[model samples]
Structure formats: structure tokens, C-alpha cells
Target: MVPQNPGAAAAGRAAPVHYTHRQILEILSGLMIAMLTTMISTSVVGTALPTIVGDLGGQDQLSWVASASLLTMTASTPLWGKLSDILGRKLMFQSALVIFVLASVGAGLSQNIGQLIAARAFQGLGVGGVSALAQVILGDVVPPRERGRYSGYMGAVFGVATVAGPMLGGFIVDADGLGWRWCFYVCVPLAIISLVVMQKVLKLPKIKRDTRIDIFGAFTITGAATVVMLILTMGGKEFDWSSMWTYLLAAVAVVLVIGAVFAERAAREPILPPRLFRNPTFVLCSIASLAVGVAMFGAMIYLPQYLQIVKGMSPTRSGLMTLPMVAAMFVTSTGSGQVVTRLGRYKWFPVVGLALVASSMYLLSRLHVDSSKLVIGADIAVLGAGLGLTLQIMILAAQNAAAITDLAATTSGVSFFRNLGGAIGTAAFGAILNNRLTHHLTEGLAAAHVRPPAGGGTSLGTPDAVQHLPQPFKGIVLEAFTQSLQTVFLVGVPVALVGFVVVLFLKELPLRSSVSRVDQAPSTSPAPTDAPASTPATAPTPNTTA
Candidate 1:
């Protein structure tokens, strides 16, 4: 056996300590709380948006409220990740929390849709930081083999927040004098608590580096994302598809993307490293992430509409009705993590998961106006299981496959693509819903020998509006909505199938058993001059916890 070094032991004791499982849990408590705050903030706003728009009187600006946040979030995600690597993770995370809380307060107090949209855009910066860094920090603290279990817990938190946000928002909206503003305010206390907890429990080693902010690259990418999102969000709804505005926006997006590629290539510390694109694992994972985002967000946004409009369920009831999906997702995500930790295998999970997502979407497409809630619940439960298995595992695979230096970039890259996909999917699917609804409504009204108003189906905004319409007109509108949503689900089926196909090509690597790659360092590196005479020159042994 090699002799221990007295001087080395002294230095080790003086150095910053690594975290134990208990300490990590303490840190995760803060992280999860922060994550929950972000999730709730985004989700809660959805149910309250109608009320907000009505109060603020900007029906034209309604979609911007969601689109603005998503646009900024996608654009800033990579920058946040790169910053964390250059600066310290903990400081960046806390900064993100403060920004989010302040923005939430601003949102709560907004007098117009413009102010609310602006506040949400600012809030997206904070959200971008938190979402990217949360995953990065997990990679920092936990070894790959053990990270799966913690990922499951995070997924469960995500699932719970998703279901609860709408329910809570609906309750607050219907409650006397609570109003839509409280939807934004409720997240404030939770965020404050998260910030305090993180300050107390989180301790990470700070690495000082020369920071080079990619200002031009940041601008180009943000512009590109904004343009793309605008085209998607406004092309069909705000402007005719054949209009010059659509073509102009699309052209501008293409140019910005090209410029961003060139800019990133020359930057000292690129926001998204071009080298990552060369990695097959990163590329495949990004594609799958994009497809998953498209599928998941499309369903999440449209299904609630189906429940509220077709079934005439209240927002609270619609949120509660989604419990079956959330519960199944929670169970599967948690269970899959434990299984991955135990077996050290994960490729099968996503492969099977995507298959289920495709199947669920197909099943949902078959629903009609008279379809029972039980059937709807069963279909969505399948979707939840698929999402649980696929979503977190992609991040794990990307993290495991990335170089140590590229960890944060990889995490944020995956997130960026997912957000991009969601934005595009939501907009594209929304356009589809609008177009199909108009066509069906026109046909149904004409068939019923009823004349549509002069604007021709322009007044149909929410399910609540449709619900109040007289007898046969309401029935016709409900049928149109049902058929339109079915088309949306049918479109989603192919997107999920693409993800399923892509996941099949993913090459799984053995999960790492340590936080760093020190064990894998070359054995030829010279030892320190002050080393003990009897010290071993071999590489450090890896932890074999499993």
C-alpha cells in the first residue's frame, strides 16, 4: 500500500470540501424550490391570460405575452450557461432568482398588456438562467450514475407544478377580489424563500476566469430567435401566410441565423460551441429534444382548450382533470431514474418513451365531441409516461457524453433547442387550430342554415365565449373545436414518431461514477516536486458505487 502524505493531507483539509449526500440534498431543496417557482410562474400565467387580456384590453397583443417570454428564454439560455462556466454557478443562479422575483412583482402590477409583456420578457432572462444552471449544477454535484435518481425528483416537481399552476390560477381568478394579478404575485413568496434557502445551503467552489461576453453573437442569436418566433406566432394569425411581412420575417430569420453561425465561430468563448455540433451524441440528442418539445408543448397547450371548449369544463376542472397524466408522469419519471441508477442503462427508456408519446397522440386524435373524460384521461396518461421517460433522460445522455469543459454548453444547448421547438410547435399548432376552426365553423354554420357575422368567425376567442352561444350554434362551434383539436393531436403524432426514430439511433455510454474526469487524466503528467517519495504515479481510481 502507498504511504499517505502528511503535507498533502494538510492541504486537503485546508481545501474547499466536496459535498456529502446530505449536503447535496440541502442544496437540491433550494434548487427544487427555485425550479418550482419558475415552473409555476410560467404555467400559472396561461390560465390567467384570458382574464389578463380582457382586463388590459389588448386582444391583439394576447399571444405576445407568452411568445415574448419564450423568445427571450430561448435566446438567452446559452449565454446564461456560458456565463455560469466563466463565473460561479451559485452567484449566477441567485442573480437569476432575484431577476425573476422582481419581474414577477412587475408583472403583478402591470396596468397594460405592454407592461405585462415587457415584464415577462425580463422574467425570461431569469428563467433562462435558472433553467440552464439548475441542470448544470446537478451535473456538478452528482455523479452520472446517481444523477438519474435526482433527475427523477426534479421531473416529479416539474409534473406537479405543471398540473397545479393552472388549478391555482383558476382558483385565484374565480375567488372574489383576487383577480388575475395575484397569479403573478403568488410566485413571489416562493421565490423569496428559494433565494434565502440557496444562500444558506449552497456552497460551490468559485473558479475565476477572464470573462468575454459575446455581445455580437448574443445580439444576432436573439434577433434570429425573435424573428423566427414572430414568424411562427404572427404569420398566420396577424398576417396572411402569403403576405410580404411573413416573407420578410422569414428572410430576416435566415440571415440572422447565418450571421450567428459565423459570429459564434470567431468568438473567444462562444455561447454555443460549434464543436458541439460535431459530436454525434449532442446532435442526436438535440434533434430528439426538439421533437419532444414540439410534441409535448403542442399537447399541453391544446388539450386544455379541448377540455374547456369542447367539454365546457371550467379552468379549475380542466386543471384537475389533467391529474391522471401528471400522476403517471411523476411515477414513471421517478421509477425510471431509480432503474437507470440500478442498471446503468438508459437508451431503452427513451426509445420506449417516444413510442408511447406517438401512440398517445394518435389515440388522442380519435377523440370526438362526445368522447368521455375517462378515455381522455387514459390517453393523456400514456403521454405523461412517455414524457417522463424521455425528457430527463435526454439531458442525462447529453451530459454524460459531453466533455467536462462543455458540460454547461451541452445542457443549455439541449434546453435552447427544446424551447425553440416548443415555440415553433405552439405557434404552428395554434395556426393550424385557428385555420381548422375557421374552416369547420364556416362549414358547420353554413350547413346549419345560419349566417356568420360580417367578420366571419373572428369573434371566437375563448371556450367561454363559445359556451354562451345559443343552442345549435354552440353545438356547431363545439364540434368544430373538437375536430380542430383532433387535427392538432394528429399532427403531433408524427413529431413524436420522429423523436422515437431518432432516439433509436442514440449510442449509450457508460455512466460516469465521479464528478470530474480527473481519474481519466493521462498517466504521464509530471508529479509535483513536493510530492511524497513513495506516492503512486498511477491515475486515481474511479468510484464504483453501483
Candidate 2:
């Protein structure tokens, strides 16, 4: 049916527009660099952190350096996305870059652990913006049907950074003159290059409209998340799990979350819009992302401990050992993305992916203290393949399902859940490991009638520290850790299956062919993109499977 007023309809939006493959690649280069800065920050620090804390002289504060960033990064993600809607995406992206660059400098020059931790926290605020905006920007620049092809490159970047960060961190700490400071300093130049390229190549139409900052909503949500994160990080380590402190913090987090809900309802432009929750696709994707985080990060963090402490490998070697997983992730993510783009069907990838995740977690649980490296490698590769298929595809589906007006919120909301899940999984898994290890150690020590070693051998500080324990004690400690890790992997199986169940319910809407959602109201929000900007023409249309 022809439009009653063709000229008026055409005037409502810019002419039908899309980017050439070359144009998309140009924009993606800048995004990929910024993405690397965020991705590698934590993992790179993981290896160098041992050396960093040793030189800085605050062994107790070591965990804070990592957790602080994660805490801030996860909490601040939604705020960044909302700000992009109020302000413009380009300015927000550039602003995050500046913040990150400055924080990196401070982190490198720090003479004390406190300063380093503080800088890392600030780095997280920036990292949060860069991380969320990258996905939001991707949605703005590419349509859902063709998005998979470019997302493949993003998966490759993620795969590379995941392994490279640890390897580079180990190399830096090992090199005579490089030092731990270089670990922070090294990304500075790459970030600066990214900033320059973004300035030159990335362009999105400027939007001018009256928009509120949603200050109250931001505060409540951040407070709620921060309180929960503090409980997770501090519990089972800084204090007793059953202590009054835990109870107090948990109560505070609950109250803050309740407050956040009300604040979001009242605010004109909430950080997380209430309506997004009503979208089935958004809810399902968020749930699935949370599970993905639990499986992916739980494995990433603990597997290293298993390799370094249980199997006696160097940090560099452990990083290298995980390459099989990375290779599998790269192949499946890219391959699956290409298939999704061609067929315009994505439900199968994540469904199959989560099944693999569940299967791999169970396989990992079956690992013995004496499991061969090849067997371990094979199990992780399955995990990599599953993660590759699920991670970004969930975001893509969420984006495709949202209205043009909700694009940024949908992208960031899913991301926030994924990171939140990671925080929860990492902390919960840590607790499980500590508890199970304690039980196993007690049993082993009693069986042999051995006394506890000089420095509380059960906790056994680092992987390096575990290696130095005397003969029988070393063997006992290794066995305890091995058993505890099996429980950790085993626990993840149920979690992955839950995510698989959630993804199965998601509605696969037809992939939109245009850069912007043409069937919605004129998008008032400013988005980062190179595509032509115009008001949408047609009345909002319901999603139909493509």
C-alpha cells in the first residue's frame, strides 16, 4: 500500500541509509581500541598485581585493587548510558577516554597501594562508560540483520584481549626494567590513538532537546549496587560470613535497592527505564547475560588458580595454556555471527551455546588433581565456544527488539546485568572455594594426623605461596584446592542450564534492515553513529519474526 502523503512521510526521516562495509570497518577500528583498553585493564592487572602489591607493601590490600575497579565499573554502567541520551554520544565517548587516560597515569605513578587502588576505581568509572557505550554505538551504526558480521570482529577482540592481557602482564613483570608501572602505562598510547581516530572518523548527528540528568535515580541505583558489591567483596574475607557486619550491609543494600525502584518510577528519565523491564526480550536477555557472566568469569578467574597453584605453571604459561579456549571462541563467535547475518536467525546460536556451557562446566567438574593439560584444554575450549556464541548475540537480540527510543537503555541494561552477574559469580565462587577448601584441608590433615603449617596453610595466600609449602603439606594443599575447584565448576553447571532455559523463551523479532528503527517515533535521544539522522516516518509497528 502506498503512503497517502509520500513527501510528508519522506520528510519525517532521512532517506533510507546504510553504511558500506569499508565505512563500518573504519568506525569499528576506533571502537575496538577503546574496547581493548577496557577489556585488558583487569586481566593485565591480575598477573602484575602480585608484583605490584609486593613492591607497594600492602599484601592485605591486594584484592581491593581489582575489586574496586570492578565495583565502580559495574555500578556506573547504566549512568553512562543514560548520560548518552541526555548529552551526545561522541562527547560522552571522548569524555570517558580522557577520564581513563588520566586514571591510567595516576595508577602508573602511584607510590602506595592506597593511591593505586583509588586510581583504579576512577579508571573503572571511565571503563564503565566505554564498555556500555561501545555496544550502544554498535546498535546505532549497524542494523540487526548485518550486525552479526561486524560483531564477529568484536568477539575476536574480546578473545584476543582476554588471553593477551595476562600474558603481557606476566611478561612485563618478568622483564628486568619494564616494571609493574609499565603495565598501566603501556595502554596509554594505544588509548590516545583510539581517541584520535574516533575524533576523525566517528560522527553522529547532534541532538538538542531538554533532558534531565536523573540525578536522584543515578545516586540510588549506584548506592544500591555499590552496597551489594561491598558485601560480596568483603564477606568471607574481611569478616565472618555470619557476622553482624554482613547483616548490616545486606540490609543497607536491600533498602537502597527498594529506594532505587521508587526513584526510577518517579524520575522523568531514569537510568534504567521501567518500561524496558516490560519488554520480554530485554528481560530474557538480561537474565541470560547474568548467567553467562557467572560461567565465563568464574571460570576465567579460578582456572588460573588451578593452573598456577594446583598444576605449578607460570602466569605466562597459564595464559598460553588457555589459548585453545580463545581459539575456539574466536572461531565460533565469528562463524556463528556470519551465519546469523546470512540467515537472519540467532536463536539457535545461543541455545546451542548455553548447552555447550553447561556441558563444559560439568566436564570441568570431572577434572582430577592429576588431569592432563590436554584434557583441561579441551574442556575450556568448549566453554570458549559456548561463550562466543552467547555473549554478544544476546545483546544483539536485545537491541533488535527495542524501539529506537530504547536502544541505548537496552544495550546498557543487558551489559549491566552481565557485569553484575560476574561480580556475584566471582564472589560467590570465591566463597565456595574457600569453604570447600577449608573442609577438604581439615579432612586431609586429620587423615594424615598433620598440624597446620606456620601461616594458616588452609588459606595459603597466593598460588606462588602454595608452591613453597613443605613436601606432604604441599601435596595436601594442592589436593584440597583441586577438590574445591571441582565443586566450583560443578556449581556452574546448574547456572548455565538456567540461562539456557531463559534464552529458549526469547522472541526472535525480524531483523531491521535500516540503520535506525523506522517504525518508531522520531528518536529524540542523541546516539553515536555515522548514519544519516532523521525523524522516523511510519507509526510504530509490532515486531514480526524475520
Candidate 3:
């Protein structure tokens, strides 16, 4: 009979149970669906933001619509990971789903920007949980050797949802009688479905451990992250880079981070163990994840702007134009995962992936106002292939290198760096775009003897502003936008190269074939018939078989 106690095997009284392919797939279906709902919630809201802000009469608070979610999501990711390690994955994941669905409903029903922002911030907490726990659960269920095969599917789901979210959001926003509220409402049903499926199918051994919650460490890290995110989101836009406000915020961020480090060291159960940083593989992987985030998010934030402003594509068309990149990412991610699983080697994937990313960024840097759509698609596809190769592989490596007990924390740590990098990259790149565009616009307008409007070059970023300008002035503005975007792409090239270089130093660890810790002694007793059949937790093996 299935053991009454799920933790029995984990406690070493019985053999660790292994899931069959069918069972694994059944579990994965729920996990992926849950993951897709989170991704869609973020993406679907993106295109609707302008409409939502207009309806809510909060033009000044526009950025907070997105920033609210991002800040809380990044800050809470590590906490969720560590919590799952202390508690159980299934409960944490379900809780996240429920929170997300409730928040979505609240967001949909909001009467003002304040309410919407608060709801979105709450949604971010859930998103953080779902994102961290999903990977942690994967680490718990799948052996490192076989994880690649499934990771490919997870990556593809992420890529697809990202691409589709905007498209669906735009459609909903433009449809008569539907409006932007439906964007939030749409996620509720899907989320409920995911919750029900997960509740029924997800079953994992719960490890009951005596561990103290690192309350002080959690506060410090959350404070540090919030400070950093605020600085990134507000530095160039809300305050001048050289302003005292900027300096004060930066100083506060640094001080908080230092405080977090000290707090972590003294905690009985650190949110992020100090030992993780000491592991060379974890360090390299974290760096690589950070670099990838910088390049990927930096580029993604601006691509639609380029298409819509420079090419004059409609929002729907702009979303459609990114299909090549998404398609290439899906294909490459799935294929690479299979290759990694079969060969039992992963180091080369990121090496080659980063190389492609660098090459694509450099190529994109050369685009001009007259660049062909085919050329743009080809450049982005290359970058997509690079992303597909690197993102999951790095996380897999980190999971493999970590001790079984650290699985959740390690997974979350890797995610934390990536999110941190994305925030920094998006902010830095936005500043670059603003600065370069302004400079180009001023020079071009002066050369044409055309006086800029009251806001000078500040208004040029708006498509409507540029479209209404006199002939020569409009052309000049378009060229400035094109040049600024090219520079942004050029900046991404070096960041991608940094990731490539970091990957080269990553120490390759043998992929373990069993779900359990290598140190855990194997039990010879047959698995209880009712218990799931699990491969014994054994030491790493050389076997390459899938």
C-alpha cells in the first residue's frame, strides 16, 4: 500500500520511490500549467497598461503598474525558495496560485491606480513564489541527468506564454465591451484550473526539518532588494543620475546589502547560505544568469518600441513580429535539452549559446532605419537560440552542484540573480536610450534649423509626438530613435560576451541519475505497492541513458 507517511522514504525507512514516465508527465502537466498562468498574468497586463492607466486617470503613476509587480516579485523569490525547503513544495505552490488568482480578481475590480498597484504588488508576491517553487519542485522530483529532457518543455512554455500574453492582452483591450479588465479576469479561470489539477496530481515527500526562519535576514534582504529596485526604476526617469536623491538611494542600497550579508552569516538558517557563494559552480552560474538577464531584458524592453515607433507597426503587428525569436527559442531550448540529456554533457550548450547571443547582439547593433524585416527576424532568432541554450542549463548546473537539502535555495538563488540582473539591465539600457535619443534629436533638429517643442527632445519618444511634427523634423526624430536603439543593441553585445566568458570557467559536474542525495544509503526493500516507484537515491553515475 502507498505509505501512509509520505516522508517515510525520505526518512530512510523505505526505498526512495521513482516515478515512471507517465507519472512524471502527469505531475509536469500541472506544474507547467501553473507556470503558464503566472507568465500570462504578467504579459497579459503589459499591453493593457496604457489603457488601464488612462481609464484610472493616473498618467503619472503609469510606471508603477509594472514596477510594483517587479519589485515585490524580485524581493520575495528567495524567501519562497527557502520556505519551500523548510516546509513543502506542493503547499507553497498552491498557496501562490491561490494568491495570484485572488490578486488578479482584485486587480480587475480596482477603482483607481492606487488599488491596482497594490493588487499588482500582491500578485508579484505570488508570482515570485510560483516561479521559485516550480523550479525547486523540479529539482526535487527529477534527477539532474533526466531534468534536461523536462526542462526543455518548461522553457518552451515560458517562451510561448511570453509571446502570447501580449497578443492576447492587446486583443482583449481593443475588443468592444471587453476592455482591459478582462486581461486580469482571463487569468482567474486558468489559475483555478491549474490549482485544481495541482491539488489532485502533485505529491512529493515532505521533509520535516527543525529549522528557524531567518526573520532578520529576510528583512535585510527584502529591504536591500527594494532599495535597489527603486533606484533602478527611478534613477534616470524620476531623478537625475547625479541628483542627491539618486546618491542617497544608492548609498542606502549599499548599506542595506552590507547589512544583509552580515545578517545572513548570523542566522541559524540563512535565507541564502554563505556556503553557496563559496561553491565555484554556483558563483559562475549566478554571474552567467545575471549577465543573461542583462542582455535579454535589456533587449526585450526596447524591441517593441523599435518596431512600433520606427517601423510604424501597430501594437498587434509589433507583437506578431517577435514570433521568430520566440519560435527559435522554443526549438533550440527543446532540442538542446534533449542533447544534454542524451550526451550527459551541458557545459558546451551555454558556451555556444552565449557565443550566439553575443554575435546576434552585435549584428543587431548594425541595424538602421532602412533595415529589412527579414534581417531583423534573423538577428532576433539567433539571440533566441542563444537564450534557449543558456537559461535552463545554468539553473540545472546550479541544482546539480548543490546538496540535496539546498535544492530549493540554490534554485531560488539562481533565479534571484537573474531577476536582479534584468532589473539593472532594463534600467541601465533605458537610460542609455533616453540619453542617446535626446542627443541625436537635438543635433538633428539643430542641423535642420527646426525648433523643438516646449519639452525639447523629451517628447520625441512618443509616437504621436513624432508623427505630428513637421516633415523634416519627423524624419529627424525617427532617425534619432533608430540610432538610439542600435546603440542599445550594441551595449547588449558586451554584456552577452561577459556571460560567455563566465560560462567558460564553469566547472562541469557529473549529472546524478537518482532523485535522492548521494550520501543517503540505498534501501533494499521493495517499494510499497501503493507508494510511487522511485529510483534509489544513489551516488552520481556515468550512465548516459535517458
Candidate 4:
């Protein structure tokens, strides 16, 4: 229906009228750069670890290399999202990009493992914003119907990064006079460019209303998350799982988490509005995302190792070998997104995707030393297709459920749980792999009647020293790695199964109208019975709350 007074609607506009195509591209470019930075840093380190550990000095810190980044990102995601709501997306995105760039430089220059880990932690904080806020900004710029196509673009960036990161990292690590440091250095300039692009192009109407940030709640949540993750990282590796120190730390973490809940409940402008939990669609999507994270990241982190150690490929070769999986993910993510947009229902995609992923994980669990490369590649591609379907679909589902007012928090909440699941999955899976590897290494050595090596276990610092060993010892180590990796895959199959179950329960909702429709409240709907009965034209559509 035509507005009786277009001037009144125009005058009541809360923010800028619209974004031009140039502006949208500019925002997307910055987001792509941010993702490129994250994927490169994550994948590059996997290939460079041997060289890095040789130079830096601790095998134990190897997991921390990745965990450091996950720790910071998982813990700080909500704060970044919440802060964007208060301070504006442009500021948060720019600040995060700058931090990541600076940290990358610091990481490249680091002389020791401690310094490197510290730098990675700082870098996580920066990239975390990009990871969480990119969706938030997209929620502002794109409607749920159109979002699937753009989300596909984001997935393609991720796939590109997975391929480029390891290949470039391997080349850099092996290059004359370059070494592993260049892996960290290469992404710094790109991050700087992303920051510049965001500053210039990411213009949107800010919430001009008064806002108060929940500083205490933010601190408690971060502190609590960090404490728990720290315990996970250290327990069973640095200290016994049953030790008093571990117990004490775990207790403190529980206390802090409880405190954080109460703080959030009472705070003004809480990081995660508790009400998001009340929506069944939001709750189911978040659960599915968490499980997907556990399955997705836990396997990706170890897939390259399976190729390099068990299959005995070089780092560069391993990177190339993993290409099919990444490529499949890119194709399926984009393809499934288009299908969902056209079909306007996402439930079937996740259900089918998780089932495929579960099947792939079961196939992966059956891998042994004699497994064919072609079969392995096919298995990985299956897993990737599952991932491609589930990961971004969950994000879009959450966005569709939320009202325009709570878009940032809703998108960020989905990301926050996915990352949290990843953090928990990576740590737990790493611990399980370590235990299984140790057990199998001892068993294999006993069966071969050979003495176990001094450093008989897998840790970040496990040297190429083993890489050069003779006879049954080398064979035994390879056996241990294969068995351990297979066990991890076995565990992941069940997790994916859980995701399948959860996705099955998710309700499909109609994709909402455009962002413009959300912004301009409709002037027609049924009036509340408690109020005076009104004609359709005089009634207003009910405002949606998160």
C-alpha cells in the first residue's frame, strides 16, 4: 500500500537511506581479506610447525600455537560483537585488523616459542572481530533471501585460504634464506589493506541512542572462558588430569562462569541478550553449529598430518593432496547456498550435509597405512561437502530468526558458539590423539621387539629427528601417527552424528523480506484486544524482539 505521506516516512528514517554497490563491494573486500588472513595463519602454521619447532625449542607448545589463536578468538568473540553494537562496526573492524597486522609482524620477528605464542594470541583478538563481525555487517547489508549467495562468496574465500595457506607456507619454509617466519609475515600487508578498505568503505548508520557496555560482564566471561580453555590445554599434557592443580583451576573456571551469567543477567546492554535462547530456532541452530565446529575443525587440523605422516607426503605435497576436500567444500557451500536461496528452505541442506559428513568420518576412521590415495581424497571430498553445507547454513538460519534490532548479537552468538565448539573439540581431540598415539607407539614397539625412543609421543616439538630414524622405529612411529589420527576420526564421526540429529530437529522458517522492510515498520496489522479495536490501515505491525 502507498504511504499517505511519503514525507513522514522519509523524515522518520533512523539512519542512512541505503548503501551503493561500490560500498557493498568495499565491505566485502575487507571481509575477504580478513578471512584470508585467518585461514592463511591457521593453515600455514600446520605445514611450518616442524621447521618452527626446530628453531623455537619446545615440542609441547606446538598445539598451543593453534590453541593460542583459538583461545583468544573463542573467548573474545561476544565482546567484539557487543562492542560493535556500542561503538559501531567500522571502529571494531578497523581496530581488529590493525591488531592482527601488528601481531603478524611480531610473530614473524619472534625468536622463541613463548614470544610466538604471545603474538598469535594477540593476532587472534584482531582476527576474531573479522570472523564475528563480517556476518554482523552482512546482516545489515543483505536480506536473508539474498544472504545465501553472498555467504557462498565468503565460503569460497575460506576454501581459497585453506589451499593457499599451506602451499605458500611450505614454499616459504623451504625457500633459501626465507624460513618459516615469512609465513607469518606474508599476511601482514593484506591485513593492513583490509583495514584501509573497511575504514573508507564500511559506512552505515550507527545507533545514535545512548548505550552502556557491560564491562564487568565482559571481563568475567572472557576470564572464565580463558581459564577453562587453559585448563583443557594444560591438563593431561602438562599435568595429570586428576591433579589438585587441575581440579582447582577447573573449580575456579566454573565459579567465574556462574558469576558471568549473573553479571550478564543484571547488566545493561549485555553482550549476549539472554532472550536469544528462548527462540527454538536460535537454540537448535546454535547447537548444530557447535557440533559442526567440533567435527569440522578437529578433522581439518589433523587431515594434513594424516597425509604427511601416514601417507608420507612432503608438506607441499600434503597441501596439494588436501586440495580436493577444500575444493569440494567451496563448490558445495556455494552450490547449496544457491539451492537454499532458490528453494527458500535450509533444513534439508544441513540434514543431508551432516549425514554426508558423518559417513565421510566413518570412512576416514577405516584408514590404514595401505589405504589408497584416491580413496582418501574421495573421503575428504565427502567430508568437505558436508562441511560446506552445514557451516554457513547455520549462520543464515540464525540471522533469519532474529529481528533487525538484534542482528549483530544474533549473528555473533552463532559464531561465538561455533568457535567455542571448535576450541573444545580441538583440545579434547588433541588430547585423545596424544593418548592414543602414546599407547599405540608403545604397543607397536613391543610387538616389533624394539626399544621405544626417548621422546616416544606426539607433541608440537616432535622432531624431524624421528623423520630420519632407521628401520622398525620409523615404521612404528608412522603406525602410531596413523592409528592415532584414525582414532580421532572415529571420535569425530559420532560428533557429526550428533550434529545430524540436531539438524534434523531444526524448524524451517520462511526467509524474511529485505533489510529495508525490517527498517521501515509496516503501518498495518491487527490491533491488540486490550487496546481499542482498529481498522487494518490504522494498525501497526508488531515490532519483533530477539
Per-candidate TM-score against the hidden true structure: 0.90, 0.89, 0.88, 0.90
Q: Give the winner by lDDT: 1 or 4.
A: 1
lDDT of each: 0.81, 0.81, 0.79, 0.78
Model 3 TM-score, all chains together: 0.88
The sequence of per-residue lDDT tens digits that candidate 3 reaches over residues 1-546 is 112333554444433557778778888899899889998887777656545765776433544676677678778889998787666778889889889999999999998889998999999889889888888888867899999999999989878886888788768876888878989999988889998988887777565555668898899888887787777667767898789998998899888889889988777678888888988999999999988988776666667667767776655666677788889889989998998899989999999999998999898888888889999889889988999999899999999998776788899999888877776776667667767877898888889888876655444434434466777777888899899888988988889899999999998988999866686434444532222246333222111111
Q: Over the stretch 390-487, how does candidate 2's per-residue lDDT look in tens digits?
A: 99899899999887668888998998998887777776777778778889999999998999887675556656776888879989989988999899
| Tens digit of per-residue lDDT, candidate 4, span 17-116 | 3555566677788788888887788888777775686678765566677778887888788889888876777788888888888898999999888999
> In candidate 1, how many clashes are counted?
0
Model 3 regions more than 4 Å off: 1-15, 46-64, 109-117, 453-457, 460-470, 520-546
Q: Which stretches of candidate 1 lie over 4 Å from their true place?
A: 1-17, 54-62, 453-457, 518-546
Candidate 4 pairs with clashing backbones:
59-461
RMSD of 2: 6.0
Q: What is the lDDT of residue 501 in candidate 1?
A: 91
lDDT score of model 3? 0.79
Error of 3 at 287 (Å): 0.7
